[model samples]
Target: MKKISPKELHERMQGEEKVLLLDVRVEEKYNEYHIEDSQVLCLNIPKTVIFNLEERDELAQITKEQPIVVTCTTGNSATKCADILDGLGYQVEVLEGGLTAWNEYRK
Candidate 1:
């Protein structure tokens, strides 16, 4: 899976790129804070629940061929998610250091 730093992702978003930004952190943590326009799909949840083929198809509603950027609290879970999506033939990228990195960028 490809990995991108939070700074690069931030710039991409600022440019109004039609990206599929996914927040793979837990719901509570996501509620506390997340990058604008990111959709939350907690990594702790079972993959069967979130990444089923049907679910992925549904997720494609937002951006079928667009770039997908996955993020978690750090970067591990998001990378895993990217691998899954990659295996499914989607273009996916992981946000390096995840939301922690994004938060740091904001400061």
Candidate 2:
């Protein structure tokens, strides 16, 4: 799967490039922290749900028009989620190093 660095994502959002973020972390973790910006639309769908979901409509929040960045606490789960999204035909990329890397990048 493709990967996007936090710096690249931050630049894209800052440039007003609309982005869709599929955060595969649990809702509680997602609520604790997540990417937020005017140009970003984030969706909190746990990795477990994405793995077991059968109906496509359940993922209606995602669209093919925009490239999606999948994220988790670490990059592992996001990579798995990206593979699933790829199979489902979504334009997907994983956030490299996931949110941990992002936090470090910001620091």
Candidate 3:
């Protein structure tokens, strides 16, 4: 797994890179605000409960080879989810500073 800064993420998106931008923040927060209109698809799977059987089962739909970038409110939770996904043989990256950094970078 790798850590990508929000600015780097923005640049990648601008370049139309294919990535799976996974938002690990809770659904409510995700609904309230999120990264909009990027080259990648953004899916919300709250980190707090991702380890649950249902969540992991739902995530099984994503292919193993897909490049996935996980984000949370502050980046800590993203790291955890990244580790989980990496252990499961998925290519994973952590969004440095998470959505907070993403919002700051957009500004």
* Top TM-score hit: 2
Cα-based lDDT at residue 69, candidate 1: 79
lDDT of 3 by residue, 31-95 (tens): 99888774878898888667775557778668988889899898999998899889988899999
lDDT of 1 at 49: 36
TM-score of 1: 0.75
Give the count of colliding residue pairs in each prediction. Answer: 0, 0, 0
Name model 1 segments beyond 4 Å from true.
37-48, 51-63
Greater TM-score among 1 and 3 belongs to 3
Q: In candidate 3, residue 70 scores what lDDT? A: 91
TM-score of each: 0.75, 0.92, 0.90
Model 1 CA lDDT for position 38? 49
Per-model lDDT: 0.69, 0.89, 0.85
**Count of clashing pairs, candidate 3:** 0
lDDT string, candidate 2, 22-103, tens digits? 9999899999999888899999888888888774455887777668999999899999989988998899999999999999
Q: What RMSD, rounded to one decimal, does every model reach? A: 4.0, 1.3, 1.5
> By descending TM-score, how would the candidates be arranged?
2, 3, 1
Q: What lDDT tens digits, residue by residue, belong to model 1 across residues 26-94?
A: 677768876764432223332343556565544545344767777888888878777887876767888
Better lDDT candidate (1, 3): 3
Better of 2 and 3 by lDDT: 2
C-alpha lDDT of candidate 1 relative to the true structure: 0.69
